[model samples]
Target: MSRLLRILFLTLLLTFTACSKDDDSEDGGTPIAGNRLSTGDSARDFLSDENFDELVIEVVYVEGYRPTDAALNNLVQFIEERCHKSAGVELNVRSFPSPNIAEFNIQQVDSIEKVMRSQYNLGDKMALYVSFLDGKFEDDSDDSVVLGAAYRNTSFVIFEETLHRFSDGINEPDRFLLESTVFRHEFAHLLGLVNLGTEMQTDHLDTENGSHCNVESCLMNYRVESGINIPGMTSEENIPELDSQCLADLRANGGK
Candidate 1:
């Protein structure tokens, strides 16, 4: 064959190979419209087209801030069951326990973001991070107790303190309920419930906080005050679930 023809053939072959690789691994998930803002609607849109491969959720915790076996199992079960039933995506969850760290005051989200990005490398999969850190989350002005924080698709719960508070003089079941409620609530945010990920077909968002739903009974309500409802935490069976509006959004946004 002529040298010129050989060069042309080589170029064609390279192009074909590149296309094949992309076809195999290209993210099948839908892209978010406009700027990638960390809004409830945007997050939902990002995960709407996740027909790619597997949905991997990484649960990380400080050595001293881990949940009980029952709590952890319940968390995994809730996540796996909900994702499979609603999103039709296969779930792969892995947990990593980091060495205990003494300081727990997170001044900003970047502190936790840095740790998450460095330790857990989530390559191309549809990934979310759940970090269990010690102490309470604080800002410059206020030092109120916080259950967790979610940005984009990552969430970290300062749960050790809260768990200790709830279980201070309670039984195992009560403690499990507290942990499970917090666990599911954070996961709900990641799922874009209550007009977070995808806009609610109806108006259920609590515009006041801009992250939680207006419904009092919904799991995404922003009233997760530490000791507000201790009696409600009496049973593990009473863990929160997504309200109908959130479920509709999930279904419309490529979830089941």
Candidate 2:
């Protein structure tokens, strides 16, 4: 072939290959609008094997705010027990430099996720993003501190710095216990607990407290995320579990 024709052919081949590669890994290319949906919007997908058979939890924490290994393991176990992910659940955890913000709102948290998160829903594998920040949530108040929040369908944030202040101290819960509880609770929101997305099997929604369950001992209880509730709730060796009503809702929603 002529030199000019050969050069043009090579360029065309390279361009076509790049475009094909991008189309094949569309989910990993960039954040999709579907991923930023409201919390609970993807509950059925997470709970059932209908849409996604595998679960990938992308855990990103700020420097000095990595979650305890025990807590992360607990989170995986919790997910396996509740979600029907026949392909299994996995966690990709890593840390980044602190944003240096004293407190974060949902918007700020979302922005961080956009920049730092690597996993996204791809084919039969669903992705969840969990951020452990060094600061507190902006909505935290002196009387009612926030521990974590599930802001998007597959995203949540844990105020790890605030959790450290409340745990592993005199008369306080163990750090792993507190972290595990918050992790499960926030993840339950993604599963649509307490009428968030999955329909409630019973009227156990704590209407006075947003999408939380009314059962005081339930993991989805509104107080579970409050600093005041930690000491009292963690008196037992085991962290809180979803109440029967909540479990019923999960079963109805295609969960195991």
Q: Number of the top candidate by TM-score? A: 2
Q: Where does model 1 exceed 4 Å of error?
A: 1-42, 45-49, 84-109, 116-124, 139-144, 168-173, 224-228
Candidate 2 stretches greater than 4 Å from native: 1-31, 226-236
| lDDT of model 1, residue 119 | 25
Clashing pairs in 1: 29-49, 30-49, 40-196, 40-197, 41-196, 41-197, 44-197, 86-256, 87-256
Task: Please provide, for model 1 over 192-224, each residue's C-alpha lDDT reduced to its tens digit, 9 standing for 90 to 100.
Answer: 665655667778887876667777667776654
Whole-model alpha-carbon lDDT for candidate 1 = 0.50
State TM-scores per candidate.
Answer: 0.66, 0.85
Q: What would the TM-score be for candidate 2 when compared with the true structure?
A: 0.85
**lDDT by residue for model 2 over 1-256, one digit each (tens)?**
1111100000000012222333333453553655667788899999899999999999999988899999999999999999999999988989999999998876677778868977888788899999999998776655556777788888888889988877787666788887888888888888987798999877998887778889987888875554333345454356878989999999999998
Q: After superposition, how far is residue 17 of candidate 2 from its true place, in Å?
A: 35
Q: Pick out the ten consecutive residues of candidate 1 with the lowest summed lDDT.
A: 5-14
Residue pairs with backbone overlap in model 2: none
- For all candidates in order, the CA lDDT equals 0.50, 0.77
